[model samples]
Target: MATGSVKIDVHHITRVEGHGNIVVDVKNGQLKQCDLEIPETPRFFEAMLRGRPYMESSHITSRICGICAIGHATASLRATEKALGVEPSAQTVLLRKLNFHGEMLDSHILHAYMLVAPDLLGAPSVVPLAKAAPDVVLRALRMKKLAGDLCAAICGRHTHPIAMTVGGFTHFPSKADLEALRQRLIEARADVDATVELFQKLKIPAFERDTEYIALSKPDEYCFIDGVIKSTDGGSWPVEQYRQVTNETCVKHSSAKRTRHQRESYMVGALARVNVNFDLLHPKAKSAAGALGLKPKCVNPYMNTVAQVIEIAHCVEDSIQLCDVLLSRGVTWEEPVAPARLSGEGVGACDVPRGTLFHNYVIQDGLVSGANCIIPTGQNLNNIEADMRALVPAILDRRPEEITLSLEMLVRAYDPCISCSTHMLDVKFV
Candidate 1:
């Protein structure tokens, strides 16, 4: 163990996305402290959303994060729909789910094979992975492209697609387009299988801490689109009751609001989803989990990469099934009836690739009176800091560079969409 004091600071973490910092303090062989600071200026998305047309909420909120634009779009639409008491047709619902699956698969692959894998493999970036292991990288990119293709088929374009609207879609994909997508996803199953196997083979550092994992859980199905907010600690409430279960408090140390449950910090994201909905996963996902020796209750945060890969496979399978249904029954493009009266409040929550995303809205005179969005990255900020506090003590004796690398690796595992939480902007470390 080293004697004196060592302070390691990582400001403006690069490569992945968003703005944040990780600081570790050590003294006299004991870890003194750690802080995960979110200096990314808040855009006051909720504050800015006041008085916009209710119908435009989805479009406006989708700009929160470029990487997860579709996720934000879907969550915002779900909340707006709830507030207006409007439900889209069955076909619209299925299409929305397909869009979400594509976004998840796309984001997960980017994180697993591109952003996160380089750290584990001691490479600088995925570019090198492409050069060194061209075949592996190509396969991974193909799977990622499939995800993009899925999104394009349903939403019209892969990035920030504009087809989604409140009540129902402005247009629906043709039957032939849907069938082609289904066929492509079916062919990519082997790639997903390989990705899952690759994740299982990677050596994940053991950093386990008992945390309250929060996610969405429905009674009959694995929740991606809708469900009640649930936690591993046996605490749950309806989506509307989220403000009661989780409290957001601001600290002088960071720009991002810290979230706590029962006065103790909790975590939400892929790990939370998998732990809360292990049984709800598609049978193939469950089988993959089993093959990887993952239990229903996974505690190690690093294992989230595996969970994400499993989810990608599940999403592909689910999309295929949904396409099969659409082919048999067909779809209709119908706009929902504009609300006869539009003065009310509603809340919505969905499980994003990162975690549970909550949106609340107040609609008056057919316009958005007010809006509040609680993103997954903001929810996990406090928990990430807590984990750092616990981890620094274990690795304080190592070289400063090694310690810094380890800490950064831990943060990347979350695959945070920081830009979404705080409007899109460059993250600065200081």
Candidate 2:
């Protein structure tokens, strides 16, 4: 290990959804501190939910994150429906799944091409890459547009969807619109192959640290919007017991909470889902994984982006099948399912683009009295720190600038939704 004294302080890390800082210190060839500090103040979405009409929970909570709005809406609706005893129709389930596919595609494509690609290609951001590789940028934009249009066709818009609600959707896409979307998804396969090729050529950092992986899983399907919370560490818990699984505790360094379960830290996201439900992936996605050299039980956090690309392929193929099913069955107008009762407590969970998201609500006399939501990023903070601690020691021989880039890449690999903004890395040698 070649180290004297090195310090890296990245103020407001770029390309993520929220604000966070990376702080590292080393002295006399020994690591002293490595931390991913989250300074963004709490938004208090759960507190905001109390005293609101039960019907409004989904809409209000959807405002939590534009990237995860559909996921929030779906989870919020499930909690409300379960508390109120409303069971959506089969058609509703299919439509909601299709809407979810749109979001998965939208978010994954944005991250893979726009956010993370810069690091892999050694550019500052996608803007420079546009001039360097125009076709790749155009491909990303095309796929993103298709994802957005798909969401609009189903949920009345991608970000903070307006159609989705507690019992069911307030709007539905026409057959013509769905058929057009299906055609586009079919056409997008070429781009999907191109994506696989792009990632295959770019090398991911060779690093592995075994950690517990968690996600929503079903025995028969690649569960996304619903299922039991399962962990690779050897147990499954219903979403109701998420508190036990998460074991969230406050940390002095972060305004956001840190979580641990079955270990000091557990990971959730595309890699977790892939490890937990590899068999359930669509056949084409499995093939993509093979080509990309990703397999179940992968521990490299850097490979999460590859897992995301694999999921993108899965979303496209499965969405086409869902479209075919809807077109074949012929959607019919149906009233939104009404609650059988007004007072009960329920929890809902979904494997969102980021990871497993949980929303719990207690409804009393048609008003929400209590609420709890655990975001993926909150669940991941501790794990990110754990990774940083492990990584810094191993790379102590590298120059300070190279070490700084590696740490930045490590954080960006997790794709933490801390906030949206980029800032410079400030290093101090003491």
Question: Model-by-model lDDT, in order?
Answer: 0.80, 0.88
Clash list (residue pairs), candidate 2:
17-419, 17-420, 18-418, 18-419, 19-418, 19-419
Backbone clash tally (model 2): 6
lDDT of 1: 0.80
What's the C-alpha lDDT at position 429 in model 2? 25
Model 2 lDDT per residue over 1-430, tens place: 8757787777877887777778888888787877777777677888889999999999998888888788889999999998999999999999999999998899999999999998899889999999999999999999999999999998899888999987788898899998999999999999999999999999899989999999999988899977899999999998889999989898787788888999999999999999999999999999999999998899999999999999999999999999999999988777899899999999989998889888999999999999988888788878888988898888888988888888888877887787411101222222
Q: How close is candidate 1 to the true structure, as a TM-score?
A: 0.96
Tell me how far the alpha carbon of residue 123 in candidate 1 is from the true structure, in angstroms, after superposition.
1.1
TM-score of every candidate relative to the true structure: 0.96, 0.97
**Model 1, range 1-430, lDDT digits (tens) per residue?**
6776778878766655877777666777666667776677778878767888888888888878776788888888878888887867788878888888999999888998998877777679999978877877898889888889888888887677788888877768898898899899889988978887777778888888888889999988888877898888897798999897669888776777778986378878877888998988899998888877678578777778778878887888888998998888897767764664677888878788898888889998888888888988888878777877787777767888787777787788888766666531122121
